[model samples]
Target: MTRLLIGALTAACLVPAGAAAAPAAADLEITIRNVLPGQGELRIALFDTANGFPDEPASTQPTLRQRADGETVRVRFPGLPQGRWAVMVLQDLNGNGRIDSNLLGMPREPYGASNNRLPALSPPRFEEALVTLGPQGAQIQIDLKQP
Candidate 1:
């Protein structure tokens, strides 16, 4: 397989993922785990850095608000163009716009990214998180915080 850099994100030239020579467009179901209990709301954004950070809409946004307590949440993005994309997740501890962080440079509020990539300890490389989307759809998991 050949890897092409379309910006910060890399696109993999996927061969027919089976008997199919190519895949038609499909949806992406993202599962988020380890959410803080009683977390008020979560905001997830989709973008294609290949197009210079052009934004792609998630099925919802500051969407997927949680009312009670839970460790995991699921969100879906439908009709994602078959290409390279990047994701940003914000945990609105108080349903606020800005994210809160500690003096140690650690997030005090809920926040995450594709592959659960962190700032320092386990920052994800482009190749490590870049994924191929197909007609059958795919699921990517992101851990909520730096546990």
Candidate 2:
């Protein structure tokens, strides 16, 4: 028993410092409101960085995507590490799997960002819509802007 105890302790100490277990992942719940009467599904995206943030309404790539339709939509992102995250929502009014935009590059369909922030003449940046997820996770609400 004494030898077994010492061996166990030695093995524990031999573990590299960098090999420590990762932090527990948390869940993120997003509630989107102000969904206008439309004919297509909603495309919601979750982004962890500024790159491709509020990506072109037609962009096919996003960290995460969910299709929903309603005056209020709720989606869950489970097992996400506690940190900053940004969300962008597009009301795909044409069911084309993307948001339509006018010639001036303004979205023709309703859209929104995390924190309910929208910048005029341009898309909202990641930092502009950042939300912090604590160890216990977080919940946020966004309101869409109509064209």
Candidate 3:
């Protein structure tokens, strides 16, 4: 019995501490600014991977739609798993639920990406707009652009 007790105690001591603790979820807050005065909806997308980033359809990823109240809009995403993420915003002036493009296939309305990144020739890549979220969470700001 004494030998059995010693062996059990030894095994217990070998186990690492805090192994059962799970990581906490993170909070992410995004603020979109410079939105043109209009009566429409603001479409926001949060992407965790580059597979289907800013241009992905609504069915494929997480998205939020909010009314365009003024020049600025704020959104909060809480309890998100800790990791890297990117953001995209579209100001749907016509409330068409989609971005309108001109003959050249260029966006006709204002849009924005995380980090305020605007590409001159092509769409912004995930790497250019990545944001890291930790236990402390993160807060970001994006400014709308028109072309």
Candidate 4:
């Protein structure tokens, strides 16, 4: 009887607080503002790794393609795991699926990154743009930067 009680206590101690309840799905809602009022598509990409950050959309974990009609566009990524994530938005003004850059490698269209982080020389790093998402999820607003 003493051994059984001790084993039970050990098992309870091993279980973390709130372990009985499963964690909620992490959802992320991103609002892209200051978009040029015109006909275009907003390409939003979510990255969980530093492998492909703000510039590489194809390498992102999940990509969201939405229409850019008004001054702002909203998108949501649901059922995401709780972790650090960064977002990148590109306003394809020419309806092109990709961001158009000039000869000098400057973006010709409006673009934005999570946490509104912008780099002076190169694209924003994942660390600079990352947001911690919890079980309750999070909402982030990014302002488009026109060049």
TM-score of each: 0.62, 0.87, 0.82, 0.80
Backbone clash tally (model 2): 0
| Residue pairs with backbone atoms closer than 3 Å in model 1 (clashes) | none
Best by TM-score: 2
Query: Where is model 3 more than 4 Å wrong at Cα?
Result: 1-19, 57-60
lDDT of each: 0.61, 0.80, 0.86, 0.86
lDDT per residue for candidate 4 within 29-133, as digits (tens), equals: 998899887768898988888876767755528898888878977889999888888898999888867788888888888999999979866788889899989
Q: Cα deviation of 58 in candidate 2 (Å)? A: 14
- The lDDT, on a scale of 0 to 1, for candidate 2 is 0.80
Total colliding residue pairs, candidate 3: 0
Q: Pick the candidate with the highest lDDT.
A: 4
If the candidates were sorted by their TM-score against the true structure, best first, what order would they fall in? 2, 3, 4, 1
User: Could you give candidate 1's per-residue lDDT for residues 43-112 as a string of tens digits?
Assistant: 7766554332212243432233444256788888887777765666666777765566667655677666
Worst 10 residues of 2 by lDDT: 56-65
Quote the positional error of residue 42 for candidate 2 in Å. 1.2
Quote the lDDT for 22 in model 3. 69
Residue 121 deviation, candidate 1, in Å?
Answer: 6.4
- Please report how far candidate 3 places residue 13 from its true position, in Å: 10
* Candidate 4 residue spans exceeding 4 A from truth: 1-23, 58-60
